[model samples]
Target: MALYDVLLALDPSPVVALNRAAAVAMRDGPEAGLALLEELAGARRLRDYHPYLLARADLLHRLGRLPEAAEAYRAALAAAGSEPERTHLRRRLAALAEAGHEV
Candidate 1:
């Protein structure tokens, strides 16, 4: 987490911020991470980045915001650059659906 903080302080790029958000999620809570992710919503670099969307989905899912998480997961699935990533996002969505939250 300290490493992420240093990286952010040095770069402060959207991607760096995204990674920092993940660290924040681990060290703090999903709410803290989600707040950081929300601050990056207007970042053009994240618009088509599956990682950013995936992070949002994961945080929202942790927060029990199933519908919103499902939406973000779908978006991440669509933007995924690899088959493995798509499969992961699909599993996440499927889990949400099994929990009675339809995407």
Candidate 2:
């Protein structure tokens, strides 16, 4: 988190911001990380980035926001750059669907 903060001060790149948000989510809570992701969602550079959607999906999943997480996972799958990533996101989405509202 400290490294990401320093790098963010110097660069504020979308990728760095994404990592920082993940770290914050890990240390603080999923809501904190989701807030940062929300802030970055408007950035043109990350509008279609798979990582951003994936991160949001992960946080939502942790928070037990199943429907939102499932949607975000689908979006991440659509934006995924690699077949493996898409497959992983698909599995997550499928699991959520199988769980239904119980998740």
- lDDT score, candidate 1: 0.93
lDDT, residue 57, candidate 2: 92
**What is the C-alpha lDDT profile of model 2 across 1-103, one tens digit per residue?**
7788899999979989999999999999999999999999988888888889899999999999888888888889889999899889878977887886532
Error of 2 at 98 (Å): 1.2
Clashes by residue pair, model 2: none
The candidate 1 region of ten consecutive residues with least summed lDDT is: 94-103
Taking the tens digit of each residue's C-alpha lDDT, what string does model 1 give over 28-70?
A: 9999999999999999999989889999999999999999999
Candidate 1: residue pairs that collide:
none
RMSD of 2: 1.8
| Model 2: residues with Cα > 4 Å off, grouped in runs | none
